[model samples]
Target: MRGCRYQACRHEPLVVVYEDNVVDRNKKRWRRNNEELPVHLRRPEVVRPSRPLSVDQWNQFAWESSQASLVPCENCGRTFAPDRLEVHQRSCKTPLPGAPRKLALQQVN
Candidate 1:
């Protein structure tokens, strides 16, 4: 298959064209979120955040999140699951100038 001439050329940024009715509705939604209207006239706000959790709850959440997260490798600084990081370490190499070099992380305990 042949590629377009523009494939490798400098391309322009995207232009989005929305219809008039859609634009007007989006404008109204923006205004509603920005300008405060009377409670009766206001759209019922669906509150997303729950009441703050206790200190123990917060600690548990932080611990769980840390354990579940994909942490950056010391050498590549790219994220990997702890189990998968070893596999990446064996093969992760970069030759690009100014790119990061991988290093081993020292364990504290």
Candidate 2:
């Protein structure tokens, strides 16, 4: 006969065993016990807002400040926000310096 692998084991096999059903039943019992507690004694449920309350005022202020600081394009005379001016100017039809005017003149000659 083979001896048990564990020194403390009195059974033929030294492995421990647990039933899944017993563990699941214990978890369900714990949840049911907690749910049965008095309303005031239980922890309050947390509610999260879609947008945070604190950032609203700061965001509004920043928008208004940026709108106030808008600069007009010298070539087109159209007002644009500073960040968008460069992109708009790149495609503007107005004659700006460093365009292909010199190349066109050379082609004509």
Supply candidate 2's per-residue lDDT for 93: 78
Q: In model 2, which range of ten residues has the least summed lDDT?
A: 40-49
Candidate 2: tens digits of C-alpha lDDT, residues 4-109:
5544464434232345466567767755754775443233222223465578876776676554445555455565654566678788776577654433224323
- Per-residue lDDT, model 1, residue 41, is 26
RMSD of 2: 26.1
lDDT of 2 at 86: 68
lDDT of 2: 0.53
Q: Which pairs clash (backbone N, Cα, C closer than 3 Å) in model 2? A: none
Scanning candidate 1 in windows of ten residues, the lowest lDDT window is 40-49
lDDT (Cα, 0-100) at 6 in candidate 2: 48
| Predicted structure with the largest lDDT when compared to the true one | 1
Which regions of candidate 2 are displaced past 4 Å? Answer: 1-64, 95-109
Q: What is the C-alpha lDDT of each candidate?
A: 0.54, 0.53
